[model samples]
Target: MTEPAFLVLTALVDEPRHGYGVVREVEELSGGRVRLKIGTLYGVLDRLVADGLVELDREEIARGRLRRYYRLTEDGASALEAEAARLAANARSATERLAARSGRAKALGGLA
Candidate 1:
């Protein structure tokens, strides 16, 4: 899954959220690394809806604006879990290799 898609799915893990809510949650989840615009947010939502990963939970009118809330499906949660695991494994592999390289360099008095 793309980073945006993964973050979107993760944002919906706790509860349904409107478009703006999802945007904020995603930004927070990514530690401000991701700031989704309105257009991009909808595009990702549309794709997730089409893929059966997200569904419309409800619609509400707040301050004369319609808020369409979205929730993650079971499949979406599973997909997110798998993606997270994959990313973690990749990170671990890189960290291990970097540590080994550092150890070698240290043993070689910073020459390796």
Candidate 2:
């Protein structure tokens, strides 16, 4: 899954949210690393919905506009969990390699 998709899923893990709510939550969850524009967000939402990762929770009419709420489905939660595990494993590998490299550099420096 793409970063945006993963971030979106993370945002919805707690509860259902409207389009704008998802946008804000995603930005917060990512520590402002992801700021999703409405157009781009809808596109990703559409794909996720089609993939059965998300479902429409409900809709409301507010200020003369439809506010659609979406929630993560069971499959969505499973997919997100899998993705998180994958990312964690990759990060662990990178950190291990870096630690090893740092150890080698320190040993070489002490020898010289």
Candidate 3:
């Protein structure tokens, strides 16, 4: 998954939050990289909810026109954790491979 989706999932990792709250949390977490548009948010949310990553929780605070709460499922947490690990491992492996190649090239008096 992309960083925005990951950030959104990570935002819900702590507690249930409404749509706007989620957008804010994701922005905070990603340092303003992932701006969750209303339509985009719902689209991602629908997929995540359908995939059992998130669920509708209690409505703690609702404005007249907006949905105001959702929590991550246990499955969602697990999935997020797994994806994070996978991405980390992939990054490490790629770094190591590039480092080795760079070393080899440098030793051979060649550009990487």
Q: Which candidate gets the maximum TM-score versus the true structure? A: 2
Q: What's the lDDT for residue 46 in model 1?
A: 91
List candidate 3 stretches off by more than 4 Å. Answer: 61-66, 105-112
Over 58-92, each residue of candidate 3 has an lDDT whose tens digit, in order, gives: 76635566565888999989989999999999999
Residue pairs with backbone overlap in model 3: none
Which stretches of model 1 miss by more than 4 angstroms?
Answer: 110-112
Query: What is the per-residue lDDT of model 1 for residues 1-112, given as tens digits with 9 covering 90 to 100?
Result: 8889999999999999999999999999999999999999999999999999999999999999898999999988888899999999999999999999998889899564
Name the candidate, 1 or 3, with the larger lDDT value: 1
Q: Which digits, one per residue and each the tens of the lDDT, describe model 2 over residues 1-112?
A: 9999999999999999999999999999989989999999999999999999999999999999999999999999999999999999999999999999999999999999
Taking all chains together, each candidate's TM-score versus the true structure is: 0.94, 0.96, 0.80
**TM-score (C-alpha, index-matched) for candidate 1:** 0.94
lDDT of 2 at 20: 94
Please tell me which model should have the higher lDDT, number 2 or number 3: 2
